[model samples]
Target: METATIHDERTEEGRRLTLHGRLTVRVIEDISPRLREMEDDPVPLTLDLGGMKRVDTTGAWVLYRLVEHRTEQGFITELTGLTPRIEALMAQVGKANQMTTIRHPIRKRHFHLLARIGAWVEGGIYQFGTFLAFLGLTMLALVRALMHPRRLRWLAILRQAEVVGVSALGIVGLMSFLVGIVIAQQGAVQLRQFGAEVFVINLVGRITFRELGVLMTAIMVAGRSGSAFAAQIGSMKLAEEVDAMRTIGMPPIEVLVIPRLIATTIAMPLLAFYGAIMAIVGGTLISWLQLGIPPAIFILRLQEVVPLTDVLVGLIKAPVFGIIIAVTGCFHGMQVEGSAEAVGEKTTAAVVQSIFLVIVLDAFFAIFFTALGWA
Candidate 1:
């Protein structure tokens, strides 16, 4: 219970503030009010700390502030009788305060903009790195399964295939059909004004076979199966089932991810081809009912107008889109931590990221094919 004693004395020379006893945080409450009322004269001041038996950062701060206030009034200050230990402590405290006093003159708006841009760039890099790592791990698992066929889980693959493909056929087909009908109606109306309504057959056939069919199918699967994959895996993560598999020397990637990834990849092309056929059927029906073109004539014209290249292009894009969707879903799922709220967030992110990547890949494919004279 060593109490601090601070005494200020003025003489013809200048002023002197004598500090003794334990000048630490505990003594601060007792010393504050009296010190605040002390004079801050614009003259040389002396701080005598030789009597001080103990000093902490708080006490040093108080001494530094008193010296600073007097110095700011066009005065000089000095500390006398400091041992090596106390001097070193005061030096460190002074350095800390000096850092706080330093400031760079920059516009606040520009500073904020730079901070935000930097944060965004950092986040982008982190996400890209994690995605590459996830992709590599998945590829390794697939390669291992390929090398050892017995390690592959056939039942799981079949089950996932059923979930990702067969169960989704009805909704995907119906949606593609409705979209095709809309396209045919719109194309026919526009072409009718030019006495070329029959060309609507070419429009529907080419667009559905080359672009809309597979693109729409990918989006549908992302919204349906990608979200499901994330929720399922995330739930497993929350239950520590993934950890258990790892503990038992079973690679969770092979057990959980391989089946889903392979199933989605295989299912995508089939779904895309099926969706294209359904879209063609819908367009043909619309042409027959609304435009008075017979279904047989529409199918005949579709065959004549749509080339094998367009179908090939759509099917080729399907597997890549499936890979993106599956990888994104599984990656987000494995990232899940904390509670069920995290599962919901990851599930939503899986759907959104899958759709975004599908569209971007579609754009690149379109450009690449066009440059290759396939457009």
Candidate 2:
């Protein structure tokens, strides 16, 4: 048998309720209806169970129900008279609730895989969206350039030239010179085995004019200028500078993008041309030093081996590379979210994606030209 009694009375500061009982399962069932009576008082209620004995899960559950019912009235609850047994029972119940939510290892792994797949899908979609935005803006810019020639600012174009073109010159120069030197040195070694060291000139010329010069120059620009554009524009976006430009009735694409597109388009071909010259010069120097060939003979053989078509082919690829670089930069910049880390990540992605696409495009051109009997 179970027994209990509740005495509710007023106190100096508030109301106090005392329950005295052997809190067995039957007693809890009887007291549940009485506990609901405490809700009439709007003041804070304190449950004093100092005389509670033999309390079990049923009693703890009754207490929980009372606390929940009191919550509906927005009254604060304080549970006192917590004996060790009652405390332990409550803790066990709470822990049991928590353990119910424990997940299996296989389930967790499945979720992890799903999360990764979701992330990859999201990335692909975001990149595709950015590419579309870049294309749309590019089309708009081209239309404006054709229709509103007087509105084009030459000063902005020159500044873009200085920024994207001149700023990238040193890196392009160094890379091309090193690439030329390495190719010449390797060619010289292979040619020396056959006592035909002079063919190294033809090797360097054909490789440079057909592949290395254009590819290396584009890669350098992608790393240097592409990243720069992403960082600059991403920072502007983060700081709301781009928004300010829009607020001022300036088309951000016209004021910012047009200059860059024109600059890179003009500068990239010239940079490719310069890279070829530097590569030839470096190869000639390497031939003179290692292969014991005179500069005059190296230059003569280079001209004879590399046709005008080869040079034009390299140049033809440059503007395409430039467009790729510009698009990647602007795309990643606009994709920047609300964090410094996002800017850095987007900038790095811009460079890597631009360079990768440039190389891939170059390969496609090579294969296409070969198929057309043009390579």
Candidate 3:
């Protein structure tokens, strides 16, 4: 036999309904009048469906519609007498009021922020470790090169020099010229206040010969040529070309990197010299126009104020920066993972870390020169 019970209780101003046993569609139709009776009251609707044994989807749908009707009328539906499992099932089927019960959105946001910071710190550590590893390898390569000078391939070195050095000329020249013009204009304004506009030539010459020429050239190389080296090596790594070289019993350091290192070291100093010349030309032109210093006076002042040692110092930093750049590029290249995204990321890290190391090294040189009464 099938049996069901519907009980009603009266509060101070409202009625509560308790339903037991299976709530079929027919039972809901029979209880429509009782539901209508409670609809007139301003109190919340309480549906005690605790004894519900087996609810069909139709019963679940009916309960959802009742909850929606209560919500539209600004009355809350309190579902009491439900087992935890039934309550969970109701929530899962979208028949229960589960929307406003979520906890702690701020904690979720805080965790998200922490995750981002952790990722950034991890990346920083990896890049710093890569820089250190490259530094060690470069020192090793340098020792090997010195020990086996005959093994250094001159043809490969010259080819790399032609590629990295010769190809960099146009961009370096343009950058140097623009830098010189800006410096001259600034010096002209400052010197004019002191009735020393002619000294703009000395200002441009000393600044360029001392720092700007070498530093700008290094930065450009880091961006342009260093990125190229890293990307090329990274691509080779992805294609397993580096592995093929290894399989063929070729020393990657000797055949690939050593040649590049030698070429860039030789070429960087020469580029520094050319860059200094372009800067002087640009500064001279700017001084002629703004400071009223003729090309002859500019040349004489430049010769007088610019020590030959300043040019030597500028050129001296180039090879060191070049080695740093190349080694960093190769290290990050070799660290490339299997994915294209990883290759690109490591290549970018190489250039950024190279530029950072160059500036840091330059700062050390600046301090060293100042201590020696050179700057």
Candidate 4:
């Protein structure tokens, strides 16, 4: 590779800087200070690139900066004798640098607290609108799939069901079981003071089946399957597979989102029921071992005290929770941009949003059910 050289010539019209040999990183490093100095010159400047043997982004950037600086200072700066390829490369680099420079001005401004708060509110409103739009599109996709069952992807739905439901069983069961034991032990300690230790079974059954069972299961699914959905879809997006599907006349929601949503909705009620059963078993074991209540007695008390309606209440919430988790995950996944960091960021957002929405919906259900005298 030829070493780059810069030769400056001063004429009546302007100062011209002729670049020779390879205009690359090493050459740019050597000539950067010289280019900076040229920017301060009062005369108009012209850069002659015809003598350059090669050019890359870094070299083009240095030249772009010099031209921008000179122009900003009211000096006419021009490029002369450039081939089509180098001119195109320089134009591309110049545009990118301009965007970066434009962003810097915004960062330099001091934002007041009120201004920041207003900006946040504005962003929230925009995001809410976007989410509503997404929801509408998903609903349309669902309708289309229903009308044309042949468009439904049964294989994908089954695969996602296994992933979102069957695989999550062990962790959901263990979490509920441990939570049940804690509730029983605490209740036993408190009830013993009142000489009602056996009431632990009633407390566990009521709380687990009516509230904690479905709530805890939803949260666990949000953290596990929701995050997985985000990561999977985000990776596909990053690979341009989602765009490719669209280019090929495939609806992404139908191909990707519907299967996961349907599977999760189908699976959650079953998981919630399983978790409730596990929780009851754990409470019963603790009652038998610690409270000295026989297993038979515990079972009899649970049957007598806890109504079937209580169990049904929890199961009723499961499908709604599933829809929230699946939709939130898939929504954030589709929002991911073109980078690895974006994928990770959106995945985190999906889990957080899913869990937050699940809890919020649970609260609404609690209120509505209580108002209806179901609680």
Candidate 5:
């Protein structure tokens, strides 16, 4: 517990800090302020440690920092007359500090486009690998549930269905309705120029049934239900509830993910069909007001022009889109780690990735249906 002292002297050569007494914790604590004053001094510093009776890790670290700081600033710092033991202690401290002291990655001066692209591709590959693993885990859970139907949580599926489908009807219907109106108005205007304004009925019916209906519902569900899944599961992750379930021999995929997957998958086609109906109603209203078509005639024309094939196409894609949304949300949710901030980040990622994947799937379906002569 011996206290150390620093003797600061300035000469024509440089500044000198001479240590006296034992250089330990108490002494370092007391001399810290005095040590800091030397930081801005650009002149050479000579640390004379020979007078020190003893030194410890704390003392060695402080002295090493002073030397390192001055050296980094392009100023000279010399340690003179150190005993072999103290010199050895200082060397060990220097190595330890270099290993972990305020470690940060040094930024590169310039990165080429190819380097950035390579990094992006590497990250994407890693992400895809993780997603495939998650998919496999989910499939295993599905198989387990199929093998033992009693283990399946039907109540949870019903609850999630209400949340994902029933609760979402209002917004989906409203958005689809508004979108339908826009499609009708725009179609009527453009077709009017060619003396084919009545064709707007065909335009609205085919577009709603074939594409916009299910696609809009999927987008809405991705933003709403997808984000909710990520946030809900991610919060459980942060709370360690997921881990606790695992500790208790409960597989999270079977308990948490499968119910949601079933609910969304079943609810999506029904929701899409309902949304398409609402959109057709909206188009009907617009046709009456803007096109001078009676509701009766509009319905009759819509029935004649739009085939059952379009409805089948939309419904076929809906369940797949639903599966995409549920998997992305739950996958990203389970991926959350560290702090609460990660929950929000993964939630956003869930929504964005779900929407992006949904659009990509939609495009693929469009091409597929066209090749099958459905278009």
Candidate 6:
């Protein structure tokens, strides 16, 4: 390898620096300080690359930096070169350096906060619109299925009912039963202070039938069946099966969404009722064992104090909760993009959105029933 050399000469026009030999990585560090000195000179600079030499990207970067430094200082800099390849190499290096030197404007903190809030509001509105559109489409599909009973997928509905309802019974039953025991135990503790421990039956019966049974059942279904719906449909979407159905002139809503919706709607009320019964049984057992309130007396008090309206309140909300969970899950499933990661993401989102919406809907129902003097 030839040694890299930099020879400076004083000329009438300016100070001329001639680069010679192989200007590669080996010599760039040694030559950089001299280049920086030349940049600081008040006189105009001319870089002469006509000398016999070899050059690579590292050497080209050094030369590019020298020119850029002089240009930035308002000094006239000239490059006299011969080879097309070196010129092209230097041009690319120059462009890359220019790109690196460019700085983006810093955003004001208050303005950025406002922009973020605006974006959040925009996203919320967009999601609301998407949900409303999905609801409308589902209603239309239901109407079409109603007009043509043969179009209804009975087998799929049964399969989904088993998946969403029958399969979930044990977990729902256990959760509600445990919740009832806790409520009864806590109510007994509190009521004993007022010497009214027997009223724990009223508290347990009213709360389990009117609120907790249906709410807990809906939340469990959202986490279990809602996520399952999203995962199943999302995987089909990723496989292009949903698109293939569309190409074959089958509406995905009719074939997929309606069955799940119908199955969930039928299943929720039954599950809620079952959950309520198990919860009452659990409370009765706790009352008997812990409070020394006999099973017979507890049952008699429950029947007399807990009205039919209390049970009806929760049952009425069950189908509505079912619809919300089903629609949210199916909507998010269809929105999944073409990837396994997207399917997973949409499945998680479906569960979260369904559960959140169920809670919100439950609150609204509570307020509405209270307004009607039913609570």
lDDT over C-alpha atoms for residue 70 of model 2: 82
TM-score, candidate 5, is 0.76
- Pull out the clashing pairs in model 1: none
The predicted structure with the larger TM-score, 2 or 3, is 2
TM-score of model 3 vs. true structure: 0.68
lDDT ranking from best candidate downward: 5, 6, 1, 4, 2, 3
Per-model TM-score versus the true fold: 0.73, 0.73, 0.68, 0.73, 0.76, 0.75
As for model 2, its CA RMSD to the true structure in angstroms is 10.7
Whole-model Cα lDDT of every candidate shown, in order:
0.91, 0.84, 0.80, 0.89, 0.92, 0.91
Clashes of each: 0, 0, 1, 0, 0, 0
Residue lDDT tens for model 3, 113-178:
999999999988987886787667767876887898887788988888998899999999999999
Model 1 backbone overlap count:
0
Instruction: Report the alpha-carbon TM-score of model 2 versus the true structure.
Output: 0.73
Worst 10 residues of 6 by lDDT: 94-103
List of clashing residue pairs for candidate 5: none
Lowest lDDT 10-residue stretch of candidate 2: 96-105
Off by over 4 Å in 1: 1-107
Better of 1 and 5 by TM-score: 5
Please identify model 3 stretches exceeding 4 Å from their true place: 1-119
lDDT of 5 by residue, 114-197 (tens): 678889999999998999899888888888898999999999999999999999999999999999999999998899999998
lDDT of 4 at 8: 93
Candidate 5 deviation (Cα RMSD): 7.1
Task: Give the better candidate number (2 or 5) by TM-score.
Answer: 5
